[model samples]
Target: MFNYTMKDNCLAKKVILVTGAGSGIGRQAALTYAKLGATVILLGKTVQKLEQVYDEIIANGGAEPAIVPLDLKGATQQNYIDMSSTIAQQFGHLDGALLNASMLGELTPYTHIHQQIWDDTIKVNVTAQHLLSQALIPTMLKADNASLVFTSSGVGSKGRAYWGAYSVSKFATEGLMQVIADEYDESNLRVNAINPGATATAMRATAYPAEDQSTLATPEDIMPLYVYLMSDDSQNTTGQVIKAQ
Candidate 1:
């Protein structure tokens, strides 16, 4: 088990937003943030899953959360802009945003990569994130302090065979994090990337079906990095890729 000392007061009065909050790392992070005293905004395509997470947070006596049903794959810039505006109107300001929604297009030979799959993956995993961040930065700037975390992967830093569009998208995410971090270097906002190593999740299972599941850590196990990145404890840290295991 992980040792978590972040109390209900750690993120008191903070307003945080998490994409992909329907499941896996994003869901755990959302719950953890709520437990730490942050009012979380859960954004995902599936409203039912987000509702379950929201109910869990409230039932546990943590903060109540807001849910926004959005599919990153089909979301437009206007949609992201509207979301940012709505969040600003409701929360006054946003203190954190976790760009965790991503797609694994396919693991196939480079020559066999379908153009449609490649395009869709890049849009969901890269372009959508970029647009969302672009729209939200203004809202976040209104806060006293802000944090942005991008979900990255091992293949992002080191190219591996058959990783295809997923790898390319992650690499783009890392670069996006770096650029944003640099732009906000003098501001109260900090941006960083976290590589959740070989976690036991649906995404992991799909990517490596033959791997021994017992050997891998659960999504719950690597939350320390997620919490640290979101907390004031790591306020000065930015533009770095971190491994969570």
Candidate 2:
């Protein structure tokens, strides 16, 4: 786990949106951000999962969180624009966003992958993220400082034999982060990516079903970096890909 401690109210008054806040790292990030004092906006495809996270935030005495059940696989640019309008009306501006939702499409040889699976994976993991970011840039600009964090995988930086579209999408994620980071280098809006290595999440389990999940790190164990990256403590950091273990 990363060595960092969050102070009480470190994120007080911030309004952060988290995609895929329904489960795994996204869920943990939403809860953790709320606990640290940010009003969280939970976005995921499943209403039930988003509601669970919302309830947990309330039960834990964290900041109240809002839920937006959106299927990233099918969401359009207009959908993101509408969401941005809603956030603008409700919160005035957004302080940060964690782009954590992703689809691990069938891990198979490139030639064996189906077109539909490839399209769905790319649509959710790559296209949706770009659309969401494009729509939220104006909202993020309203804040003196804002952080945009993209979730990445180990396979993103290297070529693997059977990772398929999932790996390709992550590589695109890294590129997206870099491009945004470079474009905003002179501004207070920072963009970065994090690779949550070997975590015991549903996605991880799906990717490595035969592995013993008990030995992997939990979402909570790797949250310090999430908190750090979003806090004012890391406003100066951007473009770099940080690994959380």
* Model 2 Cα shift for residue 99 (angstroms): 0.1
Candidate lDDT scores, in order, read 0.92, 0.93
Task: Compose the digit string of candidate 2's lDDT tens values, residues 182-208.
Answer: 999998899999999999999888889
Over the stretch 100-133, how does candidate 1's per-residue lDDT look in tens digits? 9899989999999999999999999999999999
Indicate the residue-level lDDT of 47 in model 2.
98
Candidate 1: which pairs clash? Answer: none
Ten consecutive residues with minimal summed lDDT in candidate 1? 1-10
Q: Which candidate gets the maximum lDDT versus the true structure?
A: 2
TM for candidate 2 is: 0.98
**Candidate 1: where are CA atoms >4 Å away?**
1-4
| Residues forming the 10-long window of minimal summed lDDT in candidate 2 | 1-10
